[model samples]
Target: MKETVFLTGAGSGIGKAIAKKLSADGYDLVLIGRRLNKLQETATEINRPSECLELDLSLGSQIVTDTVKSWIQDHSENQVIGLVNNAGQFLRSPFGDDQDDWDLLFQVNLMGPVNLTRALWPHFQKNREGRIVNISSNLGQTPVAGTSAYSALKAALDNFTKCLALEGGAFNIRVNSVAPGLVDTPIHDFHQKDDSGSLQLKAALHGMHPLSRMGQAEDIAGAVSYFLNPNNSWTTGAILNVDGGLSLTSKDP
Candidate 1:
């Protein structure tokens, strides 16, 4: 039987890309997202058997845990062997923004992964093998203006990845993160309202990287596949920067 991977935020962007890559590589997928229709759409594209679940990760810890448990129970035959915490909310706001915004950001970007990982940890422990790949951002390591909340949360996530790796080492559960630079995805649509603005913004972002180009979702997905592969089994507690050399540039204006 093929191993299964539970991926959060599988409806779009990096999450969707990861789903397609993993499916092609012969893993059954349990795709989770807030939009049922979008999740179903993604499921249809994959050749491997997949299940879609509608979940709002930011809702609460109990709800997230309960929902995941239910899925595990239902898919007992597949035997989940991997998890990708790819779901995240990117809210660009100044430091003095409303407190509610801060709370929501943490809940979605941080707590959601924490809750789901905690819920699935026992299964990994029982199986004596598992892989967890977190979708982090370069912003987590390099501070950028107007993304205080997102940067902070991702920073915390990176640290959390290391901590989990240390704890799960004896159990053979590998935990790692992939931090990508600016990628061409709908996530940037909020800033680029028009074609002209998008073109300018794309140029500026591309200029920030030494590669002279922004990243594609497939670029990040490739790195994720590397970590997920059992052949690359010795690596853990590592943060792989799939940023097209963006981290090498100065963060100054």
Candidate 2:
């Protein structure tokens, strides 16, 4: 029986790539994102048994959780077996003492995934074989300047992923995270917005990676493919960095 996986942030970047990859592997999908048009585009491109929900994590909307709850309630008897908590936000804010930016980043980057997973826990507990994949970032491992809030949230997420894996392992539910470096995505374009030094900084970051190239969406998606496979029964509580050698550059001789 083909399994169903609910994937968030499926409108762009790594999420889009993962959706296409999983669809090609014959998985049913529930694609969640903030943009209706982009989500529809992903759905059309995949052409699988899929559904979409337009949701914004920054809105403090409970709609996403409610949708997931309803989905589990409706599909508990079906093969709904995996989740990809890939929705997140990134910003270039300084490490100011202001609570607003800090709280906002935590809410979107950390709390959103946590909340959704908590909501979906019952389904996994009942099924005894579901898996979760949280998309983190290389910044979580090595805190960089100018992205304090974003990096901190991802770091917290990595920790929480381990906790989830440990708690869910006995139930046969696997939990893991994927941390990617600077991928060639719109997020980086937004990160580089209007900065005169952006080009130099981008080049430097690219050069720092041992691969000497920015990561592609497919690169991250490949990791998702591996982590979610039924063949991967023995792996859990792992943080796989699919970052084109960016995270490993410090280990290089």
Pick the TM-score winner. Answer: 1
Which window of 10 residues has the lowest lDDT sum in candidate 2?
244-253
- Evaluated with lDDT, which candidate comes out highest? 1
Global lDDT scores for all candidate models: 0.90, 0.84
Against the true structure, candidate 2 reaches a TM-score of: 0.91
- Point out the worst 10-residue segment of candidate 1 by lDDT: 190-199
Q: What lDDT tens digits, residue by residue, belong to model 1 across residues 1-253?
A: 5699999989999899999999998899999989999999999988989999898998888998898888888767878899999998778767787467679989998998899899899999999988999998999999789888889889999999999999999999999999999888888877676656777777888888888888999998899899999999999999999998988887633
Candidate 1, clashing residue pairs? none
Residues 1-253, candidate 2, lDDT per residue (tens digit)? Answer: 5589989899998899999999988889989888989999999999688888877776654765787778766765557788898988777656676467687888788888887787778878987877999999998998777778888889999999999999999899899999998888777776476579888877776787888878989998889989999898899999998888888667211
- Model 2 Cα RMSD, Å? 2.7
Error of 1 at 212 (Å): 1.0
Runs in model 2 deviating more than 4 A are 59-62, 74-78, 195-201, 250-253
